[model samples]
Target: MNIRGKLIIIGGAVDKGSFTETDLDKNVSNNLNFFEAGILRRVLVEAKHQEKSRIEVITTASKIPREIGPEYIKALNYLGATNVDVLHIERREQATDPEVLERLKAADVVMFTGGDQLRLTSILGGSLFHDILLDKYQNEDFIYAGTSAGAAAASNNMIYQGSSHEALLKGEVKITSGLGLIDGVIIDTHFVQRGRIGRLFQSVVGNPRTLGIGLGEDTGLLITNNSRMEAIGSGLVILVDGRQIKDTNLTEIELGQPISVNNFAVHVLSKFDTYDLKTHKMHIQSSQYI
Candidate 1:
């Protein structure tokens, strides 16, 4: 059965959304306005493509406010999503409600807000809501959108615990399980700013079965129906293909001598660029590069 209809993995939406500090306190990032604007544009455009007048924003990360807050609801509304249901499915929240499951079954677009990736998986894993999403994504007209931590969960393997600096050092790479929406790829958000190339590279070296993609802040990778991907947003998308690697001299690497590997190819994609996962090649719509 077909599982994922469409998926949009966003790096970091700092401007338009909220962030939780390492200590779990709520801290608003600086670029929420811009983040909201860019995300709204993407949502509206996607909805227009499906010819749907409205989209559904399922907010499962945050607490249950008296009602859907204006900031989030307004963002969806401006993007043409007439109906926004903020489903609070935090770890402390109850398991998937039957009513919410039915609503999710009716949704054409499912958006996961940014927060903590760990919390998101913990709450939704093996729950009825997660099962319903899997079923609908396989059989219905649904598009999944995830920003930041939500984006991290969109992949098969998530980097929940690690910084760029630590990853660059020898024997210091860490990763955790993810939602596995898109196979053959390990996704990392807030890429360039966090200097996550090392961690991504380590993931590839550890598992040559998947490609490593690092998306910069405010950027995204749109995975289409045919498994072809396109880069969007303001920054660049980094693709690391390690399938051809012959040897990874990781065991003997020092702290800062530049980790070495064989046949590890890297590519940078911007807007209008398309990447084919099956063939592992990237190209502009009309231009070619090899």
Candidate 2:
């Protein structure tokens, strides 16, 4: 099935104008606020729902919904998205609320914030809200944007918990069913900054058919048709392709033992780099940089 909607999967730590003078460094001081230049702003502009597009910000993944929800609202509003609403559906019952569903259906864009991916699936899974999300994604032109845990929850195979140190060891990474907005893929957030390449590599090794995307902080992937993805933001994204794996010791290794794999292709992409999910090929157009 061809995906009709667009997805903006972002890494965590998006700047929100809350950076203090002490936090300003060479890497951050030169960048615009999250609402101004990063993935968030890109999503708002790309949505193109209308002038002043209506956006539904789902803060289900966040433990501190109250804090995160308002931050997003303020940022969106700053970016001229005046019709932004926060859907703090923390419980299963709220996920089925008529008002909540109405808000979701009417919105031009829906965004998920960073937090616990498990909470998002647990609360909204099998609910009418989730069904609507899936339906809209396949049939409508709505925009779905997520960051951190939100990005991780966009795939069928979700990486809930895993430490970078133990990523190479057998059975170190935990995989669970996600919302399945984007299939045949696994997503890991805060990639480069947190050194999560190992975990992403493990995920791809376990599910060779599924592509692994490791999103770095302040970075994002603009996914369309569920097949093509374009890198956005200043940071990098790591793509791990295990389809050509020639050999591996994963099956023979016991729990806690380090495993090895051969012919695992890894690609590091920056802004403007594009990837084909089905072909597993990257296209770096010179015009994109010009």
- For candidate 2, give the lDDT: 0.87
* lDDT of model 2 at position 147: 91
For model 2, the superposed segments whose C-alpha errors exceed 4 Å read 19-36, 287-290
Q: Tell me the TM-score of each prediction against the true structure.
A: 0.82, 0.92
Query: How well is each residue in 1-290 modelled by candidate 1, as lDDT tens digits?
Result: 34447788888753444332354334333434554436456655665344253355545554543243355665555445666656556443455677677777777777776767877777787788777776766666567888777888887678777667767555577677777677788888889988889888888887887889899987888787637898878788999988789986777877544567888889999876889887777787656553
Best by TM-score: 2
Poorly placed runs, candidate 1 (over 4 Å): 1-4, 14-39, 48-54, 62-69, 251-259, 286-290
